[model samples]
Target chain A: MLDLPTRHLHGPGPSPVPPSVLEALGQPCIGHMDPAFMRVMNEVREMLQQVFGTENEMTLACSGTGSAGAEMLMDNLVEPGDACLIGVNGVFGGRLTDKARRAGGVVTNLHADWGQSFSRTLIKEKVAELKPKIVCFVHAETSTGTLQPFEGLADAVHEHGGLLVMDCVTSLAGRPVELDAWGVDAAYSGTQKCLSCPPGLSPVSLSERAMEKVRSRKTKPNSWYLDLNLVGNYWSGSRAYHHTAPVNMNFALHEALRLVLEEGLEVRYARHRRVHERLKAGLETRGFRYASDPEWTLPMLNLVSIPDRVDDEAAVRKRLLLDHHLEIGGGLGALAGKCWRIGLMGHGATDEAVDRILAGLDAVL
Target chain B: MLDLPTRHLHGPGPSPVPPSVLEALGQPCIGHMDPAFMRVMNEVREMLQQVFGTENEMTLACSGTGSAGAEMLMDNLVEPGDACLIGVNGVFGGRLTDKARRAGGVVTNLHADWGQSFSRTLIKEKVAELKPKIVCFVHAETSTGTLQPFEGLADAVHEHGGLLVMDCVTSLAGRPVELDAWGVDAAYSGTQKCLSCPPGLSPVSLSERAMEKVRSRKTKPNSWYLDLNLVGNYWSGSRAYHHTAPVNMNFALHEALRLVLEEGLEVRYARHRRVHERLKAGLETRGFRYASDPEWTLPMLNLVSIPDRVDDEAAVRKRLLLDHHLEIGGGLGALAGKCWRIGLMGHGATDEAVDRILAGLDAVL
Candidate 1:
């Protein structure tokens, strides 16, 4: 065994996978099309729908990570020359823009500051003007740890004849994501983030309206591996042979989703919020300020500015990891060097995990 | 935990994972950017280079199944309108054709019978005629269990100033895949096959020449997620942040690759051959005819026609799974219902597994 380091995963994601889920992951490998494994797939689908708060029949896990789900949604719904209005605030939204353009969509990006959420009124205006085939937003901007509220934006996009596609990669299961009630046409998330599963399978749900758009596409999706129609058939009734589904990964996700439902969504969200509040108070006492806007800060992914007393942020982080065995994310892109992202997500969202990070920070500082 | 019915996996892929690797997978989930995990990634790269028998520094695991590797290569290397002459024999070859088309390649399919290898002269003639930019072939077609000799074909493609790309998904560790010796510009495989890990990660290697072609692409590859340049940067020295990699899956692969190297490649290949021979003798005694071409049949995956006596093949397979807890693959596409595909891959390619399958088949018969 390659030196199994005991890391307190306080990073963006994989946020400390639970023991039961890990046990589930280690289950014997079986055929993807096996009847028994198929039952696990069916259960996983059912659980994913519950977590996503969607009644859509097209809910299933894609074979890759969160970005694969992002690519899948864009590749399937946004055909060549189809107009897409994307909210660009952080890394994930920028990634959406890139994915949409790659899928041959005529993309119009509405920019927001990295640490701030998109202005709902601005998106409404853009959607009304462009009347795009799809309106894309990142519900939780992981890079900047900002949560964009989609209260009125969904209705505005749908009214303008656009499908509402949201990237809930960092928010699903840990936050409120009412897909059916909020009128989300499509949404996708990674298992690692809030689900606390290893980062492989992507839990995705699509509304009937989104499926209709995908089915009516003028051409096949850009990547055959991520084509929703092919993957969906394998997940749903037809069970057609697409690529061999990741069997053990599915097993892991099945148990992770089970744990999520077992804990209950409302309780899970409250736990995240509780830990976030504790961490926020702890950081404030230690002279750290929230990097993301206070009004839109994500409960799970807390972005904080490096304190003035810390001369070398990298050195401090390195020492914390080396001495304390705590792993927190250094910022990405614009936030690099200026901030550190501390995640209290899924199984990591506990007073114990918060205490560990806070104690590690105190020691390092 | 979900009921994980113990199965003796003899499917085309997702061969039974060993206990140690599963334990490694169950190890504590860490941050993808953690230094310890980075070390694992580095070791995986080094071991993959050895297994592939290639000096290509670009070797790394893509974050998906075998088919994701297919799409990545097609999307990155096969530019829009570039002539690609693809060999079509089984489901994998057909998949390659679809992926290449989606990547905007001007595809010219050279068809061979499903259970037969492509004619060297025909491929040579086609290459000379089309002088395509990329010459694609499946090194081992899993659907038909036929091994197409890539020897001499690489020189032919290179002579026409083209690159050779091979799909070695089911052939990698169990078979002799001398990527550098054969002068293959690019190749991809799955962990579930001969590696006998799980089915999420795709181990891919690209020659510098192939990377150059990818670098010179006019448009970004059709996928932002599977973009080789970005993923490669993460694996190589820069270690740029890409997607949150499947952390525990990488751990599983790291241990699996260690196991592969410990056994040594030649010993592993011989073991697969030894079990294949034993299975072949038992199968022949039971009056099962090899469906794949005898001269080129893959030792790892044996595709054999069900005997005349077996009227309900599906019932026999179901009983084998339900009663004896042994699982083998049914034929796909053209060979469906006509044949049964039995795999002796990776950790599952053992005398014990072979004996178990044989006994189960006899009991069911």
Candidate 2:
């Protein structure tokens, strides 16, 4: 086996997985249809409901990464020629637009600056004008660390006769995501971001409203592997086989969800907030500035502008990884070479990790 | 964490993950774009080339299970109204037809009885008559334990100006699959079967002809996550960011491929055959008959007809799991409750494993 170096993952995702979850992942493999594994799957579903703050029965993990969740939602929810309006604030929203268009939706792209969130007024206006069947946006945009406010957007979409789909890839476990309270019709997340698990499975939940659209679709979902109705049947009590579940990955996710519940959502969210403040203060003292607005910034992913004196962003990142054994994400797409993304997610959102990253940046910069 | 029982996995797929691959999985999580991780990816691609006996540049692992690879290939290769012919002898072939139809292909499914392989003459006739854009079939049908021969089918498809896609999910690491020699345009496999890794990613390879088709597509693939063009960019020298890869799962796959190369493909294939023969002989002595034809039965998965005395198939499988701590698959689809699928794949194809399973079956029966 190849010898792998230990890394303190402060990157945009795959944030350091905890040892307990790793142990769970390394457990002996089991059959996907095994009774014991089915029990584990049920527990995972229940825990995901708790974490998502919803009573939706169709809460389960897709067998791929977070991007699979995005494709699954778009492919199943958006039918041919269905008018869909999307908030294109960051890379993820842009991705949604691409997926929606490919799924044959008449897509209306609403643009926002790289580091900004979509205003509710703009979304409401678009919903009224476009009369879209689905209104989609990201809850916590990973590309730009923006925490979009989603309080009345669902109501706006519903009033305009549209379902609401939210990409909560980076927000699910680390923040308050009240799906029912926010009236979200559908949402998706990843395990690696705030769940302190490896990136394999995507946890997705869809409300009755979203399932109704899927049930009444004129054509089947374009991707059979990601057909939520078929996948849901397997994940539901019927347990009909769709495809072989990633057994060990499910084990890891179950443990990760357990850890999240053990810490409690409120405590975990407060911890993330507290660590972000400390890191913000430390970075400011070192002459670094955040790229996103303070009110819309995500506590888990801190997007910061690259200092003017740092001539080589890649060099600084390399030095940090090589010398300090740390990993932080560089900018992507429009922000490439212009900013840095320092993630404080799940296990990585700790005081020690923040101190190490701060010290590493201080030494490298 | 839940205390999971140690199981001897003899299922149709997810045969058994070796200790080394499991150890690799438990290693510290790293960034997907980390230089070290990139090196691992490169090595995995090279090793897959050796295993598939092809130098296709597009060979890489998909971010989901084996079925996801099927979706990816069909979604990318088949555009709307594209003529596609699929051989449906077993569950996997039927699955391909479903995925192709969902991808908007004009599908012509050629049917065969369960536990049988498609004849090359029939495929050639179908290709010539249908004038399909793509011809698809499964090489090793896991559900039926039939190894379909590929002696002249590729030539037939190529002669008719059609791209040939093969599903090698259960054949790649355990059997001889000459993609270049057989002229297969595209093929895909799962890690868990003979690669001795968990089921989280699918290893896919596309010939130049396949990539050319993908490049010249008029419309984008429906499922963005499974689009090979964008995913290939991330796997290629460009190393563009597509999505967050399953970092640790890739690590496990890399280690598993290393083990396959170390054993060498010829030797591994011979071992699978030898163990399978021994298990078959033992089962025959106990009055169990094989479901598949003797000429086309796969070495990895042995589908056996339950004896008349054995009234309850589920009861025997449950007893094997509960009493013997062994796991085997029951029949699926048309063969449901009529047979059992005992696998001898990768790490689970050892003499000790075969002996233990036989003894366990004897006790349970």
Candidate 3:
């Protein structure tokens, strides 16, 4: 049998999951259409709606990772010849743009510097000019550890009679993701990050407004696997069979969501913020500063500069893995090699975890 | 916490998983970029190639269910305006046709009755007329329990200068699927079926000929999540990050593949046939007849007519589940009220399991 080494997962994702979630995941899988399995799906859908801050009946976890959720929304909502305007500031935002185009949407990108957040005023101007049918933004940029605020962004898009879509892969449970409060139409999140689940399922939700867009699509969804119109029925509605869901993964997500609700969202967010602050203070004293703007930095994913004193960053990370069994993320895209993203998410968002990374960095560098 | 009842999974796809594979799935997750986890992925890829009977270097598991594998092949291979011919016999083949059309291909479907296999001459005629870039077939139709054979089908498509794609979801390990010998260019399978693993991952492989088509595509693949060119680099080449992989799920697949190899493919195939023969003999004695042609009935998935004495088939199935905890599939698509799909696949293909189902039906009826 193949063997795997256990490590403290403190990367951008997947953060460390608790033992109970893993236990639930290991349970024997029931049939997809079985009443017992359908009950599990219903429970997961209900809990995910709570975590995502939406009461939309279409809330459910997709079978693939977080990225599949984004694809589901884009392919189902963006019809051929529809104009899509997306705010691009990181890798995920760029990916959403690609999905929109593949769905045959006429795409226009609203660009921002890496590790920076977009302003609502600028988006309003762009929305007025493009009059796009759909507008997209990344609520939390995993590649840059930047948290975008939806202060007036949704209203701006709504003013133009367009739906608001979001990539909430990094912000769902670790931070505040009030989809209803923000008037967001559609959003998707990762199970590994804040839910403290294994990374296989993507919890996604769409407002009635977003479902309306999908219902009125001019063309069928481009990808059948991620087609919400069909998949949604399997999760709820008439309880049809769209595909064989990753049964065990849903088991894990159900447990993970239960854990989040048990701990409560506000408490989870506070815990993340506290640990991130601890890591921030320790890094600042070690001649490291955040790669993202202070105002836009995310609590769950901390992007910090690699000091010049550390000549070989990869070697340092390798040593940390070998010596401490610790895992931290290297910078991605524009910030690669210049910074490191240290995650304090879900079950990993504790003083012990944050201190371990700091101590490992001290011993290695 | 959400609770799930353990059922004897004998469905068409999610057959039955062993305890050992579930244990591997519950192991602590490591980072995606961690060398240890990468070794697990490498092992899975290697074993998948052996199971697929090919030297395709692009063999890897997608992070979704069985359908995701089909979507990966169709979305990556079928570009806009490309002529494609697909054989439609049951639900899965019709699904492949749906996928090809969504990928912007000018798809021509050669229709076959449910539970019927397509003839090589019929496909050859269609290929000669369309001169398609790709031809598709479902090796095992789960919906109808028909086992499609590649006698001269591959040659017909190849002679017409096209790639042959197959859905081997229900046949990969339980039945013979000689991708290389059959001249198959691409194929995909499910972990839930013959692999005896939980449903969530789809094992897929593409020959160099198929990869060449993907590399030379005019437009980007619709799905960023299933994009082979990008995801392949993450799995092998640079080991760069694509998305957060389902870490523990890879561990489970590695263990599942290990079991397949240890059991030996020939012995496993013989075991499946033996148990299926047992069920067939018992069912024939009990006034139940196979819904498929005797020559083409799948050994792993037995579609049998619901006895006329059982006026309410759903009630019988519910009684079987509630009383014996045995889960069997009701007929789908065109055969909804007419038959039951009795799956004896992978770990579920055993004398004891087969007898248990027969006893349950005998008692319940």
Candidate 4:
């Protein structure tokens, strides 16, 4: 038997899952097609709709991680030779560009500084120039801890007769995501960050408009596992057999979603904001500066530069994990080694968790 | 709170998850990139190799169900315009053809009856004729409870310079699967079937020959999520971050694999065979004939014909679930309502479970 030491998950993801969700995950396995499991799946779909603020019947969980949801949408929507424009602000945005290209879409990249959100004016200009069939961007750029404002972007794309796709991996449950109200066509999210579930399933929602594009595509999506028409049939009332649903992970997501609804989305958002402020203040007192702009900073992931005196970034992070039993993320890609990501996500966004991470950082420094 | 009643889990999947695996699943989720989690991943990879009977370095769990593994292999191996041949004998075999087509493969389907296994001579003849880039078949067809033999098939495919891909979802741990000795280029299995873990992750393995094809592909695999190169980097010694792995599901799979290795594969297979024979004998006394051929039937999933005297199949199944707390599968696709699937897989392949399911069926009849 292997000994697994428990650590406080304050990293970018696999954030501290609640006991209820873990308990649900450990519940006895059931057949995927079992009526009992189907009922649970129904509840999961309903709760996901409430959380995503979408009335779309296409909302469901992709079996893999958040990346799977991104692939699912891109594969279905961006057909061969279809022009797709993406805002490459950070790692996730860059990933979307890669996926779009792989799906055989003619991709056009719109660039923004690593920590900066894309301006609506810039997006509108791109939409006007490229005449893209789909405009993609990250709602919350996990790599840079920047939350891109989605206001007017959807409408701009819609005006151009294009769909707006957003990656909400870091934003979905931690903040307000008005999918219907914002007129967003397609969006995807991970369960770990804001939902406080272990990472596995991706909650994806496609508006009827997006589904229409999928239905009218000239060629089949290159990925069989992610073909929405087939996957949607399984999740929809048809209950057609596709792949076996990851039953236990779905159980965990169901419980996590139940907790989100129980807490109320507003209260949960406020809690994340409150804890993030506390952590930010503490980090600032320790001579830390945020990498992202204050206005665009994500509440769930706090990206802060290491203090000048802290020369060994890896050692500091190692000490936090080894000595204090706490985990925080080092920056990824171009931001690597320059900054640390302190997550205040879902269950980890409590006052006690914030205090512990702050004290651990102080001790390590 | 929703109450999830415990069932006997005699369905095709998810067969009863063991207590140890469930306990491991309930353990606190840590960061996906955490050192401790990485160690567990290493152990899982090693154990998976032992179970798969392969020295293939490219073995890891896809962060989805059995079908995700299927999709991963097809997406990576069958590039656009690549010729792929699939043996469509059962539901899973038909799915292989579908997935291959979706992956942009020029598909050639060889059909067999629902419960019949594919003949090696037919596969060799097809391989000689089509000279496909990839040849796929199911090792165990869960839908019809047929176990296809792999003798000479891999050599025949390899002789024509085509890769052999096997769907070992129901066979891996329940029966002998000599991946290296048999020269199988790629294979994937579900955790819930023979491993007795809850359905979440799919264990996948690829031979060096299969990976060479992936590396030499002209186009990037359409799915960024299922792309093996990126996922392999994360699982391999490089440990490059691809996607946030389902940490707790990996934990469950790790523990489940440990249990399998600890029991010894041969002992486990013998146990399954013993329990299956006991149940088959009991069913025979009730005039319940098997749908699959006697020699080629799967020990893990027994597809038995429903007696004509028992007209209310759904009611009988419902009564078993409600009154006896047993869960057996109804036939899928063409065999729907004509046969019942009684699974004796992994933990459920015990004397006690077999006796209980048989007694319950007797009561229902």
lDDT of 3 by residue, B1-365 (tens): 55677688776868888899999999988888898888888889999999999998999998888889899999999998889988888888888988898888898888888999987787788888899998998999999999889856777787877999989999999988888998999999999999999888999999999999899887898788899988888877888788778888889999999999999999999999999999999999888899898999999999998888889999999998888999999999999999999999999999999899999999999
Q: Compared with the true structure, what per-residue lDDT tens digits does model 1 show for residues B220-323?
A: 89999999889988988798998989888999999999999999999999999999999999889878889999999999999999888989999999999899
Winner by lDDT between candidate 4 and candidate 3: 4
Per-residue lDDT of candidate 1, residues A50-121 (tens digit): 999988999999998999999999999998898999888888888999999988889999988899887777
Off by over 4 Å in 1: none
Candidate 4 chain B lDDT trough over 10 residues, lowest sum: B151-160
**Minimal lDDT window, size 10, model 3 chain A:** A1-10
lDDT of 2 by residue, B1-365 (tens): 78788889998878788898999998889999899989888998999999989999999999999999888999999988999999999899989998888788999999999989888888888898998999998999999999988868777788877899999999988999999999999999998899989999999999999999999999888888988889999999699988889888989999999998888889999999999999989988988899998999999999999888988889999999999989999999999999899999999999999899999988988
lDDT of 4 by residue, A1-365 (tens): 56899899888998998999999999888878778888998999999999999999999999889998998999999988989999898898889989899888899998988889888888888898888999998999898999988877777788878999989999989999999988899999999999999999999999999999899888888777788989899898799888888988888999999999999999999999999999989888878899998889999999998777988999999999999999999999989998898888998899999899989987877
Instruction: Give the lDDT of residue B251 in candidate 2.
Output: 90
Model 2 over residues A1-365: C-alpha lDDT tens digits? 78788889998988998899999998889889888989999999999999998999999999999999998899899999999989888899989999999888999899989889877888888888888998998999998999888898887789877899999999998899999999999999999999989999999999999999898998887888988879999999588999988999999999999999999999999999999999999999999999997889999999999989989999999999988899999998899999999999999999998899988987887
lDDT of 3 at B234: 88
DockQ of each: 0.88, 0.83, 0.83, 0.80
Q: Model 4 - which docking category?
A: medium
Overall lDDT per candidate, in order of appearance? 0.91, 0.91, 0.89, 0.90
State how far residue A82 of model 1 sits from its true place (Å).
1.4
Against the true structure, candidate 3 reaches a TM-score of 0.98
